[model samples]
Target: MIESDIKRYELLLDLLQKSKKEQDEQNNTLDQKCSSMINILILIITIQCGIYANVALLNEIASSEIAIIIKVLLIITLIGNFIALYFFIAAYYLKDFEGMTNEEDIIKYGENNTNLETIYKEISVDYKRTIEENKIELSKIDKIKLGFKIVTLTTGIFVLTIIICLEILI
Candidate 1:
C-alpha cells in the first residue's frame, strides 16, 4: 500500500509539473504579445496624433470644410486607442504567477533526509497550489486579452478610416 501511494504521488507530480510547464509557456507567449502590441500601439498613436495636430493647425479657420470631420475622427480614434491600451496595460501588469517549489524547500527536504513519499506529497501539494493560482491568473489574462483584441480590431478600422479620410478629404 505504501509503495502504491508513492507511485501515485510520483504520477501526480509528473502531471502537475507538465501542467505548470504549459502554463508557464502560455504566460510567456501572452507577455510577448502584449509587449509587442503596446509598442505598435504607441507608435501608431504617436503618428496619428502628430498628423491630426499638424492638420488642425493648418486648417485653423473656423469655416474650413474638413476641420470638423477631422476633429471628430481624431476624437474617436483617441478613445478607441485609449481603451485598447488600458486592456493591454492591465494584462501586462497583472500580479506575478506562483511557481513550483523553491530552492529553499528542496534544500530543507534534503537536509531533513525527507522520505521519498513525504517529499513527493509535499512537492505535489505545492505544485497543486501553484497550478491553481496560475490558472486563476491565466483566466484573467485571457479575458483581458480578448478585450484587447476586440478593441484593437475596432481601433484598427477607425485608424484606417482616418487614413482614408486624410488622404482623400484632406
Candidate 2:
C-alpha cells in the first residue's frame, strides 16, 4: 500500500511539473506576442506622425471635410491604441502562481528519514494547492490572450482607417 502511495505521489509531482512547464512556455509566447504588437504600434504611430509632418511642411492640407475626417480617424486610432496598451499593461502586471515544490526539497525530505505517510500527506496537500493555483493562472492567461486579440483587431482597424484617410488626403 505504501509503495503504491509513493508511486502515486511521484506521478502527481511529474504531472504538476509538466503542467507548470507548459504554462511557462505559454506565458513566454504571449509575452513575446504582446511585445511585438507594442513595437508594431509604435512603428505605425511614428510613420503616421511623419506623414502628417510632411504634409504640413508641404502645405498640402486637404479640404476642411477631409481634414475633419482625418482628425476623427486619428482620434479613433489613438483611443484604440490606448485601450490596447492598457490591457497589455494589466496582463503584464499579473503575478505568476507559486507554491510548487522543487526536486531538492523532495530529496531533502526523503533524506531526513521522514515517515512515508507524512511525506505522502505533504505531497498530496501540495499537489492540491498547486492544482488550484494553476487553475487561477490559466484563467488569467486566458484573459490576457483575449486582451491581445482585442488589441490586434483594434490595431488592424486603425491601420486600415489611417490608410483610407491618407488616400483621401492625397
Candidate 3:
C-alpha cells in the first residue's frame, strides 16, 4: 500500500511537469502568432499607403467608380487588420505562469513539520489552482487567435477583390 501511494505521487508529479511544459510550449506559440500578426499589420499598412499614393499622384483611376470602390476596400482592409492587431496585442498582454512556484518554496513548506500527506495536499491545491488559471489564459488566447485569423482571412479576400477590380479598371 505504501509503495502504491508513492508510485501514485510520483505519477502525479510527472503529470504536473508535463502539463507545465505543454503550457510553456503553448505560450511560445501564442507569442509567435502575435509577432506574426504585427508583421502582417505593418505590411498591410505599407501596401495601403502605396495604393493611396499611386491613386493620388498618378490620377490613373481618380474620380471614377473604381476609385471609390478601391477606397472602400482599403478602409475595410484597414479596419479588419486593426481588429486583428487588437486581438493579437491583447493576447500578448495575457500573463503566463512562469516560475510561479519554486523549489525553495516546496522545501520551506516541507520543513514546517508537515507530514507527507499534508504537504502533498497543499502542493496539489496550489498546483491545481495554477493549472486552472493557466488553462483559462490559454483559452482566452485561443479565442483571440481565432478572431485574428478570421479577420486576417477576410482582409486577404478583400485585398484580392480590390486587386482584381483595380486590374480591370487600369
Across 47-164, the per-residue lDDT of candidate 2 in tens digits comes to 6566555444223456766565665665666666666666666666565666667898799888998887677767767876775675545545665667667667766766776676
**Which parts of model 3 are misplaced by more than 4 Å?**
61-63, 96-99, 113-115, 142-146, 165-170
Per-prediction CA RMSD (Å): 3.1, 3.5, 3.1
lDDT score of residue 152 within candidate 1: 67
Q: Write one digit per residue (lDDT tens) for candidate 1, span 21-136.
A: 99888878877777887787788778768876766653654346666776776667777777777778788778577767889999999999889988998999999999888774
TM-score of each model, in listed order? 0.80, 0.72, 0.76
Which regions of candidate 1 fall more than 4 Å away from where they truly are?
Answer: 1-3, 57-65, 136-139, 146-150, 153-170
In candidate 2, which residue pairs clash? none
Query: Residue 57 error for model 3, in Å?
Result: 3.8
lDDT for 123 in candidate 2 is 73
Comparing candidate 2 with candidate 3, which one achieves the higher TM-score?
3
Q: Count the backbone clashes (under 3 Å) in each candidate.
A: 0, 0, 0
lDDT score of residue 114 within candidate 3: 67
Judging by TM-score, tell me the better candidate of 1 and 2: 1
lDDT of 2 at 39: 74
Alpha-carbon error at 168 in model 3, in Å?
4.7
